[model samples]
Target: MMRITVSFLPSELLPKPLGAVAPDGQDSGVLPATAIVIDVLRATSVVSAALANGAKRILTFADLEEARSHAMGLRDQQEAVLLCGERNCQPILGFDLGNSPAEYDRETVQGKTLCLTTTNGTKALQAAQPFEKILTASFTNAAAVVAALPHSNQPIHIICAGTDGSITGEDTLLAGRIVDACCKSFGAKIDNDSAEIARRYWLQDEQGQSLAERLRQSQGGRNLDRLGFGADIQRCAASDTINVVPQVTARSPMEIAMMR
Candidate 1:
């Protein structure tokens, strides 16, 4: 039987060994567990929307410097690569766009490539690379992420890209959404503090609360809004807005595949 668990904020803030758990004595820390990397404020949501909107590919970097270098390297590759992401909610200088799902519309990313770098989201993706599988999740595509998994017996780690490495209500809410979906599929759950807390948050936020309203109250979401990107908040919070789940398949140069 497979076991499912949820790991929320500050988990990514620490360092590597981000967050791992085992179910039924299957210690996932010592083994490769599937990781669902989430950054609900923007990153993962933008990535999912971009891929769904026909963007050639999304290249993720831990910081702007690396993303810039990658962009330069791909200069000769045509299709006009665009540098996109944010730091503390402010758009990265010289980048074509910020980490907003709405910015990835068909008109802008129709046939272009995107080089992404973010304060928290990209870092979470890097921290979970050691996992057997890494998939990006957000409210926009929560159900799709769960369906993208391999249906394996291995434990699943739902890792959130929290605000400044600290768990925010928003990511945990998204994590809980993932947890609920996972429980529905596997019939088991993580009985830990982190998982239970996330479940509670998800239930509260899901109870007729507007997606933007829930996000605006979250730490990351608030900070991003304070930085003049409040509109992005509504974009990220829209449930089921997209159907693609971006899975990290390579690291050296960042490659994501649209699953399910």
Candidate 2:
């Protein structure tokens, strides 16, 4: 049996393998297994909702300029596309929307392709692309992702794209959920340094408050509150809002499609 493991970030800051120095580029190396990347504060959650709402596709771009160019090209053909993302925790100027799942509701995103760029999530996905396999994960699709984990003999890595290049409570807590789900579903245990740290964080959150409440207390959570986006945080923290798993396929710009 392949031993499953999880790694919560900010990679370099976390300590040991749990917090490795995040790779310089996408070529981190062969993972020899699977990796589920998470940015539960909003990115991954929004991606899940967008796809569930019938988004034609989501094109994640690390650079805002590039994403805009792509969107402009898409628009030139008269195709309906929406440009959305955030920078410094606020909506970028001239974007169709920010990085909020509520903004991606069915009526808004259906039949549209999202051109997205963010401070961390996009960069994290790009940096971790060298892994053998990558999956996008969030609380919205935790159960489905748990069931979808590759059963072949290979380790699994859960990479949490924390906020502003730092590990926030929400992402680490989400990683903990994945780690716990794995332990219950696979009857396997993890030994990775990161998994241990994530497990501890999960247990801490589970001790008193509900997941949503815990998320509301995170660093990103407070920022969202001050910015009047508190509702978005609650929405993202809701468990199983949608049942589809979003996977990052082997393609450019890293499209997120429903894993079915």
Candidate 3:
């Protein structure tokens, strides 16, 4: 049976391979599974928009300077490169673009390469390196992501990139939505308590609140609002609008491209 696991936060994720046992009787090594990384409040959303709108590829960096340096190097080679990211919920001062999905419109990102970094999203992607396949998911491309899942028995892990090292409701909610979809579409079974909790959370309604309103109440949403990004919250909360799934196509510089 296809098993699905959810990691509410990157820290909560095991050392990979779900249940692999090492020679010392310890859990270690990589998993021959697919990992979906969600950063609904922004990063993964941006990736979906950028790729869907025509960006050549997105290379993620955990460090702001590193991303800048890499973009500069690519630019020096006469390549179209844009440095994109955010710090403390605002765009980096010298970056060509911020973490907002709106900024990645086709006109700006088409045929260009993006070097991205962020507080939580990029870090979550780094932590998910142990999986055989890494895909980025957000509300914008949720359905596309579900369609990209492998039908084999290999486990599927969903990792949520919470806000600032803490669990955020937005990420968990998206994770739950993915799990719920997998269960319905792939007949996948929830593998653990985290997965079950996430699935339940996604199905719960809070006093008739809309998904966008619920996102505005999340920790990451509030941060973006405080920084004058209220519009971004609505855009990020959009469900399955983008028809592309951004998968990690290269790992040397960690590039993400639309799955083809």
Best by TM-score: 3
Q: Write the per-residue lDDT of candidate 2 for residues 1-260, one digit (tens) a residue.
A: 54666655535423333322234534343555677888887888888889989998888998999999999999999989999999977899999999888889899999998998987888667656656677888888888888888876677777778876667888888888888878877865785877878877787645667777888899878888888988988788778768787777645878877775
Please report, in order, the local distance difference test score of every candidate based on alpha carbons. 0.78, 0.79, 0.89
Indicate the TM-score of model 3.
0.94
Clashing residue pairs in candidate 2 are 11-19, 18-194
Better of 2 and 3 by lDDT: 3
Supply candidate 1's per-residue lDDT for 163: 76
Against the true structure, what is each candidate's TM-score?
A: 0.88, 0.89, 0.94
Count the clashes in each prediction.
1, 2, 0
Sorted on lDDT, best first, the list reads 3, 2, 1
| Residue pairs with backbone overlap in model 1 | 9-167
Tens-digit lDDT track of model 3 for 158-253: 999998789999998999999999999989999999999999999997889989999999998888889899999999988989999899998877
Model 2 poorest 10 in a row by lDDT: 13-22
Off by over 4 Å in 1: 10-30, 205-207
